[model samples]
Every structure is written in structure tokens, then in C-alpha cells.
Target: MIDETDESLNKSSLVFGNFAVLVVFVLLVGGVYLWVSKKNKTGQQVFPAGVNYLSPKGDEAKKPVLLYDFAKLAESSDWVTYKGKIYPFSFQYPKVLTPLTFPNDRSDAVTFKVNELSPEQSLLFTVETISSRDKNLVGKPEEFAKNYWKFFSGLKALNKITKITNEKGMTGYQATYVVKGKNAITSDNYFFVVEGDDEILLHIGDIFPTEGKAVLNRLVNSLEYKK
Candidate 1:
């Protein structure tokens, strides 16, 4: 009877030991699973090696400047009325020609004029009406870009463009091109243009390097037109 009792107690103990082992195994497996899930949730793994980290809050990185009011510029007398249309009065020295108008079939059209100070030195300004569609006009920006390089390609070219920026710190380009002739005389031409919805302004002035580019930039920046 004592042997039988001992056997029964040993069996019970073995069963209890097995149950305890199983509970420990289950607890270890659950802990491992929870740790792996937590790591994935925090984006701690390297998805692509050597890739740079990006800021999650990128929208708050940049602040934009406020544009100047267009209406306030229109009221100034610096604007002169020509052919029933008002244009900003430019400096008188460079000498602007009679503006030539080109009528597009649509409500938007283009007007162009060339200001020639000398045989090899000239400035061209074109004012065009713009619409939503016109914003993406083919070669618009490229054509404007060529003005800077065109002077460099001409024969006996002695010109360089300087201090080019647009009005509103937005849509505009400017440059000063200097030209030298065979007689060793030198001339400077300055060009500026501002674009708007109903009208555009073009300024071409003779460059006086000693006078610096600030004068021309101020004039271009100060330009205002009627809506």
C-alpha cells in the first residue's frame, strides 16, 4: 500500500510539472510576439539602407512672403496713358519706340516694341495679356531666357547681363548687356519685364555700370499697373 501511494504521488507531481512547463513556454512565446509587434509599430527597422531620413512635418518648414497690392500701384501718376491704355512711364534716355500691337483671336493679345539706342545695342519689351491657358505658353520662359544669351552670340559682342530678378519676387527677369564697338566705344543696355493678368510692363534702359544695378531693380520692383 505504501508503494502504491508513492507511485500515485509521483504521477501527480509529474502532471503538475508538465503543466507548469507549458505555462512558462506560452508566456515566453507571448512576450516575444509582443516585443516584435512593438518594434514594427515604431518604424525602427531600416527599410532601405543608406536612405536619408525625411521630416514627418515638412509642411511647417517653409514660409512664403506676401505679394504687394496691385491696386495701390495703379493709382500712381508714374503711369502714362497711351492709345487709351495706361503704361508706366519709363526712363526717357533709352528712348522707346511706338508700341506695335498684335491682336490674338482670343481676348488675350500681345504688343511688342524694340528700343534701339545704337546699331549693335537695343532693348525689346513685349506686353501680353495672360489667361490661365496662357500661363503655360510654349517657349514663353525659354524665349525670355534667350535675351540674356543673345547678346553674347552677336558679332563683335561686348555685352554682359547683371542683376536679374522679377517683380513681386515672383514672375519677372532682368539683365544688363554691355556692348563694345570697333571704335572702342562702349554702351550698356538694361532690360526688365513684369507680367500681370491684363497688362505687362517692359523696361529697357542703358546700363551705367558705375550707377550699379540697384536703380533698375528698384524701378522694376516699384512698377504698378491697373487691373
Candidate 2:
């Protein structure tokens, strides 16, 4: 026979165990409800705000670098492809940069100010298209590139003229000069190609070595001719 005292103890233990489980379940459900109901002063849920605040800042930090990676992988990335209105040649530039076009210039000129880099003088890019008639078709593109600096007064190239061959084997020339009264070195790039009977000269200018010379290099290297 079962002991009477043992039966009483068993009944009491069962009641206490059920009560303990019920208490725990209630606490858990209540905690979830409180968390779900929490909101800001404007009655918007806090969790979404928390996620938005944290997630976007982490992504925002990476954007500037993606824009600044001019040499390594910009053309392959999300940069916008631009075909010159002044000329038929095409190239890619960072999407974050807005293009400023000149309508009245003798040569079709486009300028973009690169804000990602830090320098006292600021990094600026200017490109123009000059016809063979304007420059007077003379020698090869490299020869014209070497002699073209003579037009500018008091500005002499500080570095030796360098020949740059792009991925397509298209050749371009680069020259850097120390401008008077400026602390930075100014870089100039030139690419020559023929379209029909016209010898086309494409010029990109004024990138500081201390600031964004790689960007200038990338831009020059990215050039493509339709003609």
C-alpha cells in the first residue's frame, strides 16, 4: 500500500512544479510584449530606428573609399560611363562626381571637382577636345605632347614626359609641373587619336600628385575612341 504521507507530498510537489512553470511562462511572454511595445516619443518603433541608425553608418563609411579607388577598380565598379559631347571618345568617372559642362568654350570642356581627396589647393579635373586643325597636325601624338607645353608661358614640366599605355594599348602622355606660388604639383594628360581625316587631341588637366594623381592616371587610361 502507498503511504498516506508520501501521497500528500507528491500532490504538493506536482502543484508547486506546475505553478513554477506557469510563473516562468508568464514572465517570458510579458518580457516579449514589453520589448515589442517599446517606442520613441513620436510613437515609431525603436528597433527599426536602431537598425537604420547602425546599419547605414557602417555602409556610409565604405562609400567614400569606393569613390576614391580610382586606379585599382573604378572602371569595373559602379562608376558612370561618360562619352564626350565635344568628341566621340568615352571614359568612366566616379558616379558620385557630377559633371560640369561648358557650352561656350572653343573646345568642348568638362570639369569635375573631386571632393574625396584632401589637399590645400583642392583636386580639380578639366578635360578638353582639340581638333588637328586647332593644334596643327604635326608629327605623332607623343611628339605633339612633348612640344605642346611651349604654348603656356613660364610653365615648364618638372618631371620627365612619361608615355602611358592603357589596357587597349592606346598610348597617352603625362607631364607634371610645379606651378609658381603653389605648394602642389599639377599633372597634365594628353591622348591623341584619329577620327576620319581629323587628328583629335584630348587633354585632361590639373591633378595634384599629393592629392589625386592616380585618379588622373585612371581617367587617362580609361579613354576609348569611337572613331
Candidate 3:
């Protein structure tokens, strides 16, 4: 028969063990939270199972190649300037594309879509405020873009996300992809820059046919943002 003192000691030991386990669990959870928070602040993308990411290229020649006569396009195509009503940003686009409506508040999304919707003819351009600071977005814009690709609903990337910058000094992100049941490939480019407490998203989407893509790339190269 065990003594009453032994029973009390055993009970105390069991309780102490349970308490220690709880403390360890809490510490582990907190460490994970801090790690994720740091990753988000630095901009990291989470990849899904079975999804592949291509290694970045060392030279411009090794990246996904898109050939077009930029000099000819720049020399011949008429261009127009577009200023946002909500965000203090502006950019230029060729006259071949039409500008659509956007909001006039703290954030907006301006789109330029081709009038025709052919598989190869379909093209789109968009500029908007990210509103992440306002909406309390958990991660950086790159992370958001990666999440977009991971669960893109209908599209998957054809190449790795690339880093790009415009002549106006605005840095941007670019990703190219091909959707199922579509004859044309698409490129989604996202430009983000911070102002005050908000970040801007200049998303450019283009479908195949090298001419239109070239025109859009020209427009991207001309993007600008106000201080």
C-alpha cells in the first residue's frame, strides 16, 4: 500500500509535468508566430505541393525571351498619359489600347482591355492601390502574387516570377503563365511602391501575339509614380 505522502508527491509531479508541457507548447507556438511574421515582413512566397519554381537567370538573355522591335514600336506607336484620380501615380500607354473607368477614393483600379476578345488578341492593363496597409494584409506584395499563382483558380505559371524595373525608376514583379483551354499565353506583371501608408499595384496582363505584348511592355517601361 502506498503512503498518503507518496500519493500527494505523485500527483504534484503529474501536475508539474502537464504544466511544463503546456509552457513548451506555448513557447513553440509563439516562436512559429514570430518566424512567420518576420518572413512576411521580408516578402516570402509559399509554394504548394507538386508546384515547381524555375531558378532565376543570371543575364537578361537567359530569362524568358520575348522578341519584338521595340525601336519600331516606340517610334511609330502614338502614346497617351493617364493620371489616377485616387492614387498619385501616372503612366503612358499606346493609343491602340483604351482606358477604362476607376474609382476616385483612396484606392482605385484602372484597366485597359482590348476591344476585341480573340485568344491572341485579348490584352489587359491595370493600375491600382494595394490597400494592404488599410486592409491589414499579412504579407508583402510578392507573397500575395505568389498566393495568387498558387491558387490562381484557372491559370498556372509558365516561368518563374521575375524582377523588373521601369525607366521611371519604379520596380515591379512579372510572371508569365498559360491557362488551360486557352490558345494564348498570358503575362501578369505587378508593380508595387510605397507612399505614406499605402502600396500601389500596377498589374499588367497581356495575351500572346508579340506585337500587342511589345506595345504593353513599352507602356510598362514608361510607368511613373508621384512622391
Off by over 4 Å in 1: 1-85, 88-139, 148-167, 178-201, 207-209, 212-214
- For each candidate in turn, the TM-score is 0.29, 0.52, 0.52
- Candidate 3 per-residue lDDT over residues 1-227, each given as its tens digit: 87999999999999999999999999999999999999876634432211121222344112333334445656665778888676566778766556666445344445544323332223244444445423444336665555445344345555457777778787757765544344433445454544343455656554323344566667777777785
Cα error, candidate 3, residue 89 (Å): 1.4
lDDT minimum window of 10 residues, candidate 3? 47-56
Ordered by lDDT, highest first, the candidates read 3, 2, 1
For residue 24, give model 3's deviation from the true position in Å.
Answer: 59
Clashing residue pairs for model 3 = none
Better by lDDT, candidate 3 or 2:
3
- Compared with the true structure, what per-residue lDDT tens digits does model 1 show for residues 120-200? 222222333322224433335424333433323222332344455545443444332322222222233333344443223
- The model with the greatest lDDT is 3
Ranking by TM-score: 3, 2, 1
Q: Distance from true position, residue 199, model 2, in Å?
A: 3.3
The residue ranges of model 2 lying beyond 4 angstroms of the native Cα positions read: 1-76, 115-137, 178-185, 195-198, 206-211
